[model samples]
Target: MTGRERHGTGARLRRMLAYAVLILFALVFLYPFVIQTATAFKTEPDAAAHPLSPIPDPVTTEAFAQVFGGTGFPLWVVNSLAVTLLITAGRVFLDSLAGYALARLPFRGRGAITAMVLAVMAVPGVVLLIPKFLVLNQLGLYDTYTALVLPLIVDAAGVFIMRQFFLSVPPSLEEAARMDGAGVFRTYWSVILPMARPALITLTILSFQSSWNEFPHTVVAVQDPALYTLPRGIANLVAGSLGAGTQYPLKLAAALLATIPVAIIFIVFQRYFVRGAAEGASKE
Candidate 1:
C-alpha cells in the first residue's frame, strides 16, 4: 500500500479503538442504572431472585405504589424540588456574580480571596460539617429552611467554574459595551450574562444535581423528618423504614425516581455542558 493508504488505515483503526473505549465506559456507568430501573418495576421476590437482571420477569408498579402511597416519598419529592430549585437559582446568580467580580473587578485582596476559594475547594467538604453546624446554630438558623438553603447557595466549585468561564470570554466584548455608555452592572447583565449560556447551563445542571442528591448537609442542617430531602428520606427508607425484610424493589424505586431529574437535566443541557467543559479546559 502507498504511504497515504497506510496513514488512512491507521486513522480508521484509531477511530475504531476510541469508539470501543467509549462504548466500554458507557456500559460501565450505565449498567447499574439499567438494572435499577428494571428493579423499580419488579416484584420484591423477582428482584431478590434476579438482583442483577436488567429485565423484570413479572413487571409491576407495586414498588412505585409503595413509594408514593406508603412512604413519605411524596413529601421528600416536594422538599427536593424546592431545595434544588432555590439552590440552583441562587448558585447560578451568586456564583456567576462572584465569578464576574473576581474576573473583571479590580478589588483589594483579589488574589487573597481567589486563593482562599481554591483552598476551600481543595479541602474535603466532609471536614466542614462541624463548623457549618456550629455557625448555623449560633446564628439561630439551624433547623430552618434558611439553614437548608443558605449554605449551599455559594459553592466554591461553581464560583471557580464560573470564574474560569468568565476569564475565557473576550474582554473586547465588555469594552465595546462600555464604549456604548454601558456601566459595569449594565454590561454584565445585558452583555456578559447573555453570552454565558453554556457555563450557566452547566452550573444549573450541577447545582440541581448536587442539591437534589444532598444527604450530608440535610443530616446536619435539620433533624425534622418534615425537612428530609429525597436522598435523606431514601436513606431512611433503606435503613430504618423498610422493616423486617429487605424490600429491594421499594428502595430501587426511590433511587430510580431520585435519579430521573438529573437524567433529564443532562439530556437537555448535555451540549452546553460539553462546551462548558471545553471552555474550562481551554481556560486552564
Candidate 2:
C-alpha cells in the first residue's frame, strides 16, 4: 500500500478504538442509573429475581405512593427543599461577596484572609463533622435549621471560584464604573455582577446540588426526624422498615426522586457546568 493509504488506515483504526473505549466507559458509568430506574417500578420479588433487567415485568407506582404517603418522605422533601434553597442562596450571595472583595479590594490583612481561605479549603470536610457538632451544640444551635444552613453559608470552594472568575474578567470594566462615580458596592452590584451571570449560575447549581445531596453533614447536625433532609430520611428508611423486605423498588424510587431536581438543573445548565469544568481545569 502507499504510505498515505497506510496512514489513513491507521487513523481509522485509532478512531474506532477510541469510540469503543468511550462506549465501554459510558456503559460502565450509566448502567447503574438505568438499573436503578428500571428496578424502581418492579415488584419487590421481581426486583430480586431480575436484578440486572432494565424492564420490570409488572411496573407499578405503589413504591412512590408509599414514599409520599406512608413514610415521612413528603416532610423530608419539604425540609430538603427549604434547607437546600437557604444554603444555595446564602452561599451564592456570601461567597460571591467574599470572592469579589478578596479579588479586587485593597485592604489590610487581605493576604492573610486569602491564605486562611485557602487553608480552610484544604481541610477535609469529614474532619469537621465532630468539631462542627461540638460548636453547634455549644452555641445551642444543634438540631435546628440554623445548624444545618449556617455552617455552609460560605463555602471556600465557591469563594475561590468567584474570586478566580472575577480575576479573569478585565479590571477595566470596574474602573469604568468607578470613573462614572459608582461606589465599590455599586460597581459590584450593578456592573460586575451583571457580567458574572455565567459563573454565578454555575455556583448556584453546584451549591444546590451539594446541599441537596448532603448526608453526612445532616447526620451530624440533626437527630430529629422532623429535621431530616431527603438523603438522611431515605437512608433511615432503607436502614429501618424498608430493609425488612426486598423493597429495592421503593428504595430506588426514593433515590430517583431525590436525584431528579439536581438532574434537571444539570441538564438545563449543562453549558454552565461545562464552562465551570473548563475554568477549573485551566486553574489547575
Candidate 3:
C-alpha cells in the first residue's frame, strides 16, 4: 500500500480499538444498574439464584408494594422531594446572584470575596460534618426541615460554577443593559440570566441530584424518622429494622425510586450537562 493508505489503515485500527475500550467501559459501569433493576422485580429467592441476570424469573411487585405500603418509603420520598426542591431552588438563585456579583460587579474587596469562595470550595465536605451539627444545634435548627434545607441552600461549588459561566459570557450584554438605565440586579435578572439557561439547568440538575442522594448531612441534621429523607430512610432499610433478611429486591426497588428523579433530569438535559462539563473543564 502507499504511505497514505498505510496511515489511514493505522488510524482506522486505533479508532476500532478506542470503540472497543469504550464499549467495555460502558458495560462495566452499566451492568450493575441493569442487574439492580432486574433484581428489584425478582422474587427474593430468584434474585439470590441469579445475582447477575438482567431478566428476573417470575417477576413480582411484592417488594415495591412493601416499600410503598409497609415501610417509611413514601414518607422518605415526600421528604426527599421537599428538601430537594427547596435546596435546588435556593442554590440556583443564590449561586447565580453571588456568581454574577463575583463575575461582573467591580466592588471593593471583590477579590477577597472570590478568594474566600474558592477556599470554601476547597474544604472537604466530610470535614464539616461535626462543625455543621454543632452550629445547627446552637441555632436550634436541629431536627427541623430548616436544618436540612437551609445549610445546603448556598453551595460554594454552585457559586463557583455560576461565576465561571458568567465570566465566560461577554460583558457587552450587561453593558448594553446598563446603557439602557438598567441597574446591576436588573441587568443580571433580565439580560444576563436569560442567557445563562444552560448553566442554570446544569446547576439545578446537579443540586437536585446531590441533595436527593445526600446521606451524611441528613444524619447530622435530623434525628426524627418522620424527617428522614430517602437516602437516610434507605440506609435505615439496609442497616436497621428492614435489614433483617436478604431483602435485595426491596432494597433495590427503593434505590431505583430514589434514582428516578436524577435519571429523568439527566436524560432530559443531557446536552446542557455535557456543555456544563465542557465549561467546567475550560474554566479549570
Candidate 4:
C-alpha cells in the first residue's frame, strides 16, 4: 500500500481501539445502575437469588410501593429536598460572592483569607465532626432544620471554583461596569453573574450532588426521624430496619429513587457543562 493508504488504515485502527475502550468503560460504570434498576423491579426472591444479574426474573413494583408505603421515605424526600435546596443556594451565592471579592476586590488580609479557605479545604471533614456537633449543641440547633442547613451554607471548594473562574473572566467587563457608575454589587449582579453561567452550572451540579448524597454531616447533625434525609434514612434501613433481613429489592429501589434527581440535573445541564468547559478554556 502507498504511504497515504497506510496512514489512513492506522488512523482507523486507532479510532476503533479508542471507541472500544470507551464502550468498555461505559459498561463497567453503567453495569451497577443496570443491575440496581433490574433489581428494583425484581421480586424479593429473584433479587436474592440473582444478586448480580441485570435482568429481573419477575418484574414487580412491590419494592417501590414499599419504599413509599412501608417506610418514612416520603418524609425523607421532603427533608432531603429542603436541606439540599438550602445548602445548594447558600453555597452558590456565598461561594461566588467570596470568589468575586477575592478575585476583584482589593483589601488587606486577602491573601491570608485565601490561605485559610485553602487550608479548610485541605483538612478532612471527619476531623470537624465533633467540633461541629459541639457548636450545634451550644447554639441549640441540634436535630433541627437549622442544624441540617446552617453548617453547609458555605463550602471552601465552591469558593475556590468560583475564584478560579472569576480570575479567568476578563476584568475589562467589570471595569466598563465601574465606568458606568455601577457599584460593586451591582456590577457583579448584572454584568459578572450573567457571564458566569458555566462556572455557576458547575458549582450548582457539585453542590446538588454533594448535598443530596450528604451522609456524614447529617449523621453528626441530627438523629430525629423528622429531620432524617435520604442518606441517613437509607443507612438506618441497611443497619437494622429490615430486622436482620436483606431486602436487596427494597434497598435498590430506594437508592434508585434517591439517584434520579441528580441524573436528571446532569442530563439537562450536560450541554452547558461542555459549553462552560470550552468557554473556561478560552477565557484562561
Per-candidate total of colliding backbone pairs: 0, 0, 0, 0
What residue pairs are clashing in model 2? none
Better of 1 and 4 by lDDT: 1
Alpha-carbon TM-score of each model against the true structure: 0.93, 0.96, 0.96, 0.94
The order by descending lDDT is: 3, 1, 4, 2
Mind giving the per-residue lDDT tens digits that candidate 3 earns over 115-207?
Answer: 999999889999999999999999999999999999999999899899988898897887788899999889999899998888898899899
lDDT of 2: 0.90
TM-score for predicted model 1 compared with the true structure: 0.93
* Candidate 2 weakest ten by summed lDDT: 275-284
TM-score, prediction 4: 0.94
The Cα local distance difference test for each model comes to 0.91, 0.90, 0.92, 0.91
Off by over 4 Å in 2: none
Per-residue lDDT value at 106 in model 1: 91
Off by over 4 Å in 3: none
CA lDDT for candidate 3: 0.92
For candidate 2, report its TM-score.
0.96
Q: Write the per-residue lDDT of candidate 1 for residues 149-205, one digit (tens) a residue.
A: 999999999988999988977999999999999999999899999888989998998
RMSD per candidate (Å) reads: 1.9, 1.4, 1.4, 1.8
lDDT of 4 at 156: 96
Which stretches of model 1 miss by more than 4 angstroms?
Answer: 1-14
What's the TM for model 3? 0.96
Candidate 2, residue 6: Cα displacement in angstroms equals 1.5
